[model samples]
Structures are given as structure tokens and as C-alpha cells.
Target: MNFDYKLFEMINQFAGQNQILDQTVMLFSKFGPILFGLVFVWLWFSKSGKKVDNRKIVLYAITITVFALGVNKVIELMYFRPRPFVTYAVNLLSDKTSTDPSFPSNHSAGAFAMAWALFWHRKRIGSVLLIMAFFMALSRIYIGVHYPFDVTAGAIIALIVTAVLISQRRLLDPLYQNILQAFRKSKGQKYYRNM
Candidate 1:
């Protein structure tokens, strides 16, 4: 009983079965990260995070996503797993699909990393983002490009990275604050010298 393959097939069986559903899932698969990125940008400057350091939260989220992508690439180089479309007959959504190893999905890793980082700072907003993150992971399986386990592994990588970064906030805070201080000095902010 190959549960990974079986679950992947179950989700992928719906691929190409309907045009509208396929397009909807494809949107999540392809654009979810960009949408989340937009959210981060909006949150960065918004006044809603009055009680929290909004800029730091968004910066950490961006850093986590970048690091998760690097981890995914390194793992791919060390151990390869062919995409579902390569190993089996699949209703693949794109002819321009990636030929890279697919043990852990880059999209899933990036999306989940960003989402989880946000969630730790704002529980309400994070809950919604996490649900969207889950859907994005499922979209990868539904689109027939990745196996179930691939997205699962990506998500696990995201969780670990987000946790480590969030837990080590004390170490990262001073570095970011110093960067901000330098920026203020370069920009000639009047209050720069007071700090």
C-alpha cells in the first residue's frame, strides 16, 4: 500500500476533469505566494500592528521564505525524486512544468513559511493565511505536478524553519535594528543621533 502515491492519485484524479476547477486550483498553485507577498507588503506599512513590530514580522516572514527555498534546493541537489508527471501518467496542467527534483515543493515551502511566520505574530490573520497555505499545498497535488508526500515534506520544512527563526527573535532583533539605524543615518533622519 503506497499511501503517498495513492493519496496523490486520489487528489490528481480531478485534474483536467473540469476546466473551472482546474483553473481555480491552478491559481492557488501558482499565485498564492504572490498574493501572500502582497499581504505582507500591506501589513508592513499598515497601522494595524500598533502593538507589534510590523516591519520585523514582515521581514522575518520574507527571510523564512527565502531560507526555505534555499533548503529545498539543497535537498533537491542531495536527493532526487522525480515529479509525478515524470514517473506516472498524469493530467498535468502545464506543459512548462519544472523538471527539477520534486521531493519537497518550493511553492509549498515558500507559502507555508510566509504564512506560519505571519501567524505567530497575529493569530487571527495567521489562521486565515494558514488555511490558504494548506490549500496551496493541496493545489500542488491536485495539479498533478507533485506527489502528496512532496508537499508534505515542503510544509514540514517550512514549519521547522519558521519555528527556529521565530524562537531566535532576540538574536535577529539587534541586527535588524542596526540596519534600521544605519538607514536612518544615511537618510539623515533628525532623530538618528539620539539613538
Candidate 2:
């Protein structure tokens, strides 16, 4: 508990230091989730060899992220933790404020879900996403909207969710296949038939 505050202090200490650095981190924290979705879209349309498998992987990752986010919402309802800025005297960067509970960050949970999901299949892409996800999670702390434990808990939740979903791949396989087949037959997706 004490260590959580110390770790958060170490990270949030950087806030209000420099405009350029703060701006960069703020941008990452804001758009990191959107970037993850865009990456999946890009992967779906890429000329990569394993088109079918890539699409399936994208679906799996998306499902995991969505599932983790749902879990976060439920957890927030049961256990509410105030934002750091709301509780302490800290350097708050962004002007935004949230009524939502701070424990188990939704941003970190969803981002890490995508990162860990992709990491299992595409190491290079997954590694890059994972790194970006970490920085994004750290940025949340720097902005003083979340404690370090919030992001850490979020990441742990993502790990557990990813593990559970991956283990149930068999249940997901036929669903992915059927969805892909239906999508392939849709208008403007004729080329997907060969994929």
C-alpha cells in the first residue's frame, strides 16, 4: 500500500515539468486505445499471408479487451477508489476529471488485453503494442488521474483474462470461423473468399 503511493509519486513527479514531454505522454494516454483498434483494422486489411488467421486473431484480441473492460466496470461498482488528484496534493496535468472509480484502470486493462492477446501470436507487433501500452499506463499515473496500483491491478486483470480466453480457444474457434465466413460473403469482401 505504501509502495503504491511511492511508485505513483515517482511517476507523477514528472507532471508539470515540461510542456513537450507532458504533451507527448498526454497524447499517448488519450489515443493509445484508439491506436490499438486501428492496428487491428490495419492487420485485417494487410496483404499478410495468413489473412484468415490474422482476422481471427484480431477478433480474439478485441473480445478479450471488451471482456476485460466489462470486468473493470463491475469491479469499479463493488470497490470504488478515488482519483489521486481528488485525494492528494499532486501535479495534475489534464483538465479532465472523472466520476468513475480509480481502482483497476479501464484504459490499462483494455490496452494490455490487446497487447497480451497480440503478443501470443505476433511477437513483433505484440511487443511494440506491449511497450506502448506500458507507457500509456504510466502516462495515466503521470497525469495524476490514477494510482500505480490502479494500472497494475488493471494489467493483472488483463493477464488473467487473456489466459482464460486463450485457454478457451477451442470454444472461440468455430465462432471465429463462422463469423469470418459470413463476413467473407458480405458485399465488397469477395476477395476475402480466397483469404
Candidate 3:
């Protein structure tokens, strides 16, 4: 309803200092969702060289995609919060892209969903992803698109979804594996046959 000017000014000041960091924030703010999605798809489907475990990849992708979409839609419908830039007197440094409601940032939700999903498979990769997700969340605030609470809610939602998915991995693994096999077969690729 109302903007928190003190918090906004703090984030704005933090974001205003470094040109490279600002550009990084802007770039991720604009394309991080698409880039992360592409990375998920590629990790799951690519048959070029490495023998990636298809089962884990598919499960991660499914978990992240399903949870991100469900949480985003529910929060958007329930909260309908305005973007920070729309509600506050802040200098929006990034492009005004996206018309979606701001509470529980979709970007942060997606990033954390993907990060936690990957964490289930590979600890190192998941650590990197988690770090990336953190930055992505900060970028949403830094660029004046979302508030700290929004990003925090998104991260929490992602963690909940990931926990549920991981707990049900036993039940879901078979179907996910089958889907991955079908995908590999469709591509006429044997990259993951050994795995």
C-alpha cells in the first residue's frame, strides 16, 4: 500500500555505487529468468557430450517450473502488490519491464526454485545457483522493481516447494525418468543412456 522510503533509500544507495555492478543488476533484471530457464532446458535435454543424469535433471526442472509457476500465480492473485518503482519516489536505474504485481517477486521465486532443485542433485552447482539466486533477488530490489519482503517471500516459497518436491522424489522419480527417456529418444541421442 505504502512505500518504505528508508529501506528504499538504503537499497538505492547500495545499488548506485558501482557501474559494473549496476549493469550486472540491470542485465539480470532483464534476462535472468529467460537465461535460467534456458539453462534448465539445456541441462535436461542436451545430448552433446557429457553423461548427465537425466532423471535428476528432469526432476529438478519439473520441480522448479511447477513450483515457480504455482507460487507466482497464487501470490500475484492474492496480494496484487505494486512494484516499488510504481509506488515509491526512487530512481529506477533499470528498464521498466514487466507489468506483474511485485509482492513475492516471480524472478526470485524462479531463481530460488531452480537453485534448490539443482541443490538436490549437485551440491557445488547448487551452491553457485543459490548465490546467483541471491543476487537475482537483490537485483530486483536494487533496480526498484521489488521490496526486500517480496524477495524474501519468494525465497521462502521456493524453499517450501523444493522441500515438497524432494520429499516426493521417490514417487515422482519413475515418471520423470520415463519422460527423460522419451526426450532422449526423440532427440535420437544417447548421451544419458549410460546414466
- TM-score for each of the candidates: 0.91, 0.95, 0.83
TM-score (C-alpha) between model 1 and the true structure: 0.91
lDDT, candidate 1, equals 0.84
Candidate maximizing lDDT: 2
Error at 159, model 3, angstroms: 0.7
Model 3 clash pairs?
Answer: none
Query: Tens-digit lDDT track for model 2 on 69-145?
Result: 99999999899888887888988887788867999999999989999999989999999999988987899999999
| Per-residue C-alpha lDDT of model 1 across residues 20-111, encoded as one tens digit per residue | 99998887777788899998889866877342377778778988998899999999999999888888998899655788898899888988
Candidate 2: 10-residue stretch with minimal lDDT: 186-195
Model 3 residue 166 lDDT score: 78
Higher TM-score: candidate 2 or 3?
2
- Cα-based lDDT for every prediction: 0.84, 0.89, 0.76
Model 3 agreement with the true structure over 4-115: per-residue lDDT tens digits: 5567567877776788988988998788878777766777666744444734664676666687769789878977877777776765787665668987777888888888
Number of backbone-clashing residue pairs for each candidate, in the order shown = 0, 0, 0
